[model samples]
Target chain A: MNQQNILFTNNTAQAIDTAINNIRPNGIFVLTDKNTAVDVWPQVKAESTMMSEATLITINPGDTNKDLKSATLIWENLINGGATRHSAMICLGGGMITDIGGFTASTFKRGIKFINMPTTLLSAVDAAVGGKTGINFNGLKNEIGVFSPASHVIISTRFFNTLQKRELLSGYAEMLKHGLIDSAATFHKLIDSDPLEIDAGHMLELLKASVEIKRRIVNDDPYEQGIRRALNLGHTAGHALESLAMKKGKPVPHGYAVAWGCIIELILSHTHCGFPTNTLRNAAQYIFSHYGTPDINCSDYQDLLEFMHHDKKNISSECINFTMLSNVGRINIDRTATESEIKTALDIFRDLAGA
Target chain B: MNQQNILFTNNTAQAIDTAINNIRPNGIFVLTDKNTAVDVWPQVKAESTMMSEATLITINPGDTNKDLKSATLIWENLINGGATRHSAMICLGGGMITDIGGFTASTFKRGIKFINMPTTLLSAVDAAVGGKTGINFNGLKNEIGVFSPASHVIISTRFFNTLQKRELLSGYAEMLKHGLIDSAATFHKLIDSDPLEIDAGHMLELLKASVEIKRRIVNDDPYEQGIRRALNLGHTAGHALESLAMKKGKPVPHGYAVAWGCIIELILSHTHCGFPTNTLRNAAQYIFSHYGTPDINCSDYQDLLEFMHHDKKNISSECINFTMLSNVGRINIDRTATESEIKTALDIFRDLAGA
Candidate 1:
């Protein structure tokens, strides 16, 4: 089921053309959000002659819009536009577009072919490789979805030119996490450099490394039954904070919350997994200084815990699960943490913020 | 992906118990309709101690309720019930229950194990063997779905005692179709017998043969890419008629519609595919006499053709696709039918009704 083939190209137009020629779909549908429709679609249109004939479907640009309603809209549009099972869909936007589009394609007519042309850095590196496709349901993130991979994931850094500084920083957080989880040297190098100032050549190299780390884990455990849990090192806490922010109607960007969660989980790793205190302290200092702290505090811990209970990784309702690290690139999955320990870790996170 | 294991038993209770013990899921969810809730669940509860602890979810019985709204309700219930990724769902009812329940389980928390306990003969012989799971969307039958097989499909004949005459006759349509599409001897045997009067032992043997026929086709092409389209021999015209009936609010049961559709298509098969004229005459006479000719006539052909365009099997708008039969157990898929040809076929169908 992990059939996604990755192609990194500087000339995205050539890549898109090549893919379309190979698939020879009966029809082509391009899915985008309002933001990508303006900023990114023109470039895609200019690059491939295929866009002239492809049907375009756009949704509102936000995580809140990535719901069943949006999926229904896409399905209806595809049906109305004469989409056959042999037709192909091109998801050309950020993570929200790719996630919802992949899900729509996976389900529409009982699964059609789709290609992901991830425009934002987060999607290109993180969402592109994994076969996870879904939409948020009942105020829960990714509570409804399937493990269906794309036919192709075409990555090009050209679309980054349209991204804002904040979005770039959000994407950088995942890249930073990949480095920390897989290679201490890469983490050190990433932290030493100003993420916002990276050249295209260097950024592509970083993207390849980050995507490779995720690809290896996902390929080994496509269903997330084992080693793939390691990829959730920061996500257990990250998703909780993200959900709470969304529920409160003051949403935090996903990567920023993840960077913050990594700091808290790093502390947990130090306490339970025999992680070196000095390494944790250094990583914590860099993350806090760069990503800054989220507005959530000790008062939000209970709400966050409520969110954690609904996390897909948890088997029982009693204890929260986390992927804790014994050392960089050496981690243990399904590690349980008590509410008291979570509060203590949050305290350590706060202390590191002040320090 | 074709991993479903079929279990045949007179003692369904013991089978349920064995399956539950083998899966040993963190939680069990039983999905049933109002009818099955009253007729079948008591048997399931008495048979398996697991049901004592399982959460039971019921939906209103009918094809109209098989939609995204119902799927959303099921997902919300599962989430609220503390159903983890390790939870398993038991779809215990007819085609409607199995179809929608399978969709709910397939998408819940990115899928969980689901076992099919098909109560009606239609589901046992047709829907049970196919890994097709879905809910109808936007006024279309099975418009949104996935090809995810169940962990197990448990068949039993005890539930047949509770079915109404019409319901029993409806399920018998598929059993008849399995014969028409795969074996002429089976078709002749079924035509000679009274479906409702068959003893349990004989009925079970017929079901095993029917299920085996469908299983071979599905295993050869689980995704309906090629040979599986043969299973859609009657469905092309059958679905169009069913959708029209549902739209007009004079809904016919699925198997009856398929039985009618099979007669119409058999005529098309004779004219277009060199099928023996006498075989078509005999089969048509049997189907018309047993199922009775639907109220459809020349007036309904336009509306039925309108429905056929959206059949999910067509490649273009110009011509509707049908799986034409060359002979019993021999089919040519993706065959095109023009409006004129369709009208002629309907004319032959009307002539048969009068005859």
Candidate 2:
């Protein structure tokens, strides 16, 4: 039912059942957010019989709710329910649920088996392929956490039925990243995709393919010590923009920020890593046409750069770590860009993106 | 310089230099408590040329200060000091220092390389052999933690020159348990030694042998999934006694409580697993001779029982997790004691120990 601990299924509840059978836990705890508990949890239980037996624990929705308070709630529930070393926790919903749930299970009694059932399109590709678990702390995103991966990453396309067109496009940004890092063929596949059509069964195959690229990279470097940083291709600048959006009280989807950031990164790649110019231009064009531009200006540059300085991938305080590329799949990892070059990239971003 | 990641060095600072070389870190952060900063940090720096370059981060002393606030201070210091992923942290002090330091290093940026220099006798024996890193959370001991093993465990006997006789004898309790679980010969070696002197060079050899036994057991079960319960021989009852002592404002040393608990566990072994009565009596006699037993009465039995119920080893709400032995070196792990049997063991403890 599950291959390489990633289950691609039409029935997410059945996938949870498969994970239960795999672990044969003494107890089962299901964690979801308030929104997902109402919209998704009931649907999951309707499809499978055994899933209803799991003790339901819900938190609030969004990244704001994915805090220590939520983690504490989950911990208290597991303790109250008398969870044992042999018990398993099922994290349902999106990346926020999986991230915090994986963290709690990893720490409670010094870790317990956990299965991640990622409901959002973004999480299906992003959170599915890696073992990064954490929660925000001290005004930092995932500032305190560990590399505690899920025992199983169960992705069900059926859950994407609730998503809007913007949500579909958000996930597609990461899929495009998988392509740009993998091969030209995968990149071209996404550029040719219609954003309004993840409902057409084509998205399932695309997601599986996208997950394969990240899975191969994550398998090689589970701790992100070296080559595994390829997954952080666009995340450096994207994260800063995401932070800026949050601070401005106009938050955007994670993939939207990533897509915009990848454009700047592609230019950095062309300048530093000798990435081909036409490919960079074409990629940026695709992003500009599909993804809405963030309200960023030269005034925001200083703050974005400040956020980049705080990136987790950094090796030294003097420089920000950049995962650049020479061409599709020709990764030039551990690269660095000067402050001036970063400004240049931003300038190019402003001109091309018309922001 | 280091064998099996554990360095028995005459110079503690030299061992830290060895760890730095092994990791080739971009930066170094040394974490110590206030007392250690006053005493051990100077000697460590006086012996080494390069150690002064490291950023020294000190926290308040004792388990009371080993909380989230302390962990936050460490994290903030590391962040402000511009620690990178390639940086290494040195935790130099007792169990509390190593515990919180290991935890902060493990979680900060999803873990950084950390070295443990257990300056105290208790820490060298207990913290060195295991990978348990934690901080007290929400009024519970080690409620939030991870099993992040140190990159290096450096031990220097010169640092033991600062310990009181009580501290030296306190550590002897765990060393005695190590001998009991290892073999009859090891147990006899400890019972034959005097408690007045750990500086006579015999304690160093004894400490090495004790650590070897624990090292072997820990290597086999790093995560404590199975086969690691043997190491929990006395901890279950020991921790309860330790808690009771803490609550009464008459705190006993950790090893003293463990020695007392081992006596009760030995009686349970005799009742359940046919442990030799003479061997049990001799072990109990050795404990009663050196380690002072805390005052306990039948009225306090309920509190002690409740404390045991809150032990981390328990798997279900119904029964407590116990690690009993059939004989010397023949462990009967995953065993459970009924509440009545526990009471009976306590009764025997009172009769023999004059509690």
DockQ values of all predictions: 0.87, 0.66
List the candidate 1 regions with Cα displacement exceeding 4 Å. Answer: none
Residue A341's lDDT in candidate 1: 91
Which CAPRI category fits model 2?
Answer: medium
User: Which digits, one per residue and each the tens of the lDDT, describe model 2 over residues B46-81?
Assistant: 777768888999999987788878888999898888
Residue pairs in collision within model 1:
none
Clash number for each model = 0, 0
- TM-score of each candidate? 0.98, 0.96
Mark the 10 consecutive residues where model 1 chain A has the least summed lDDT: A289-298
Give Cα-based local distance difference scores for all models. 0.88, 0.84
Cα RMSDs of all predictions?
Answer: 1.2, 2.2
Q: How many backbone clashes does candidate 1 have?
A: 0
Error of 2 at A137 (Å): 2.2
